[model samples]
Target chain A: DAGITQSPRYKITETGRQVTLMCHQTWSHSYMFWYRQDLGHGLRLIYYSAAADITDKGEVPDGYVVSRSKTENFPLTLESATRSQTSVYFCASRVGGSSYEQYFGPGTRLTVT
Target chain B: AQSVAQPEDQVNVAEGNPLTVKCTYSVSGNPYLFWYVQYPNRGLQFLLKYITGDNLVKGSYGFEAEFNKSQTSFHLKKPSALVSDSALYFCAVRDAGNAGNMLTFGGGTRLMVKP
Candidate 1:
């Protein structure tokens, strides 16, 4: 509620189903990002928003969508879940200007069977 | 585009010994480097960063990083290790000249501190 939070810390879904992961931050930061973590790939950016209503694709944007209509919210959606999409999702935010650090959420573990 | 590399998959150190985690990066423009640590089930926690000035940067939990321009590396270091310091370490880089300022992270290195 204060820093950054991800809903449904753990979720189990089946392939072909639709799922959405919610992220909320109270810091009013202008930059928000979505990332997925895997074993050898580390963390790959899925999507990022510079401000409300301004979102862009990252290194790994396949099979994922993100929208940020409010400065405090950024949601990632999976139109059709797949086993390859199963991984931990992280939400992060950074202040505008010269700041270089991004604050991260606790993360959501999604499992697709 | 910016990219980062962490060469070691894992580093084992005994308690009270000095420790270091290596990181290298490539960026089209000036580099902004960072280090983050993650516990078993927790998200990444910022450790330190190097933007400009003083190549030596200090950060949370008794951690420090040195930015080497010539080598294009920013390595994390600590004077002594602790059992509680074991975690996954990641290195990230950003291009200061890039407007987006998006950070690219390394594959990560596991630091195992043994007693």
Candidate 2:
């Protein structure tokens, strides 16, 4: 309950539809990150937020959008979902620093048909 | 540009035996290396990291990694393996020169520990 958590641990949506995955962390970490896990590609960062209202694109930011209105929450949105976007999404958080370790949420498995 | 490479796709070991998972990285400057484990249907769990100081860094669950700067490698190791350790392990790196602190993860290596 106190640790990070993600909503709709599993999701199914159609292509071209909009879907949003929610992530919340009780730690109130300054840095929040969104990553997608895919076979062969491993885990690629989609977006990251340094603090409230501060966000930046990661390695694989195409086809995805993210917002950090609150330090405790960072939500990722798909404007127009595609089959290629279907993958396991993970959210992580860490204190703002050079050597801080990141903590991850359970993850959301999204399938776009 | 920063990138990581996990040479082996999978590793198999017997319980109680020593285990090793190899990882290599390329970064623009000093590297911040890390190891994470992911179980079935689960998110990645932080294992260990090598920021500076000692070449050998010890972390959670009796896991440790040795950072070799010359070789640009950080291999995870455990003295004795357990069946519970069977999972997907990922190696990541961040370029110290970059201020964003973005991590680049390797293609992950699945460890199969047989009891």
lDDT of 1 by residue, B14-101 (tens): 9999999999999988998989999989999998888899999999999999999999999999999999999999999999998875
Residue A85, candidate 2: Cα error in Å is 0.8
lDDT of 2 at A107: 96
Residues B1-115, model 2: lDDT tens digits: 9999999999999999999999999998999999999999888899999989999999999999999999999999999999999999999998988877688899999999999
* TM-score on alpha carbons, each prediction: 0.98, 0.97
Residue-level lDDT of model 1, residues A15-43, one tens digit each, is 99999999999999999999999998999
True contacts kept of each: 0.76, 0.82
Off by over 4 Å in 1: none
Candidate 2 structure lDDT: 0.93
Per-candidate Cα lDDT values, in order, are: 0.94, 0.93
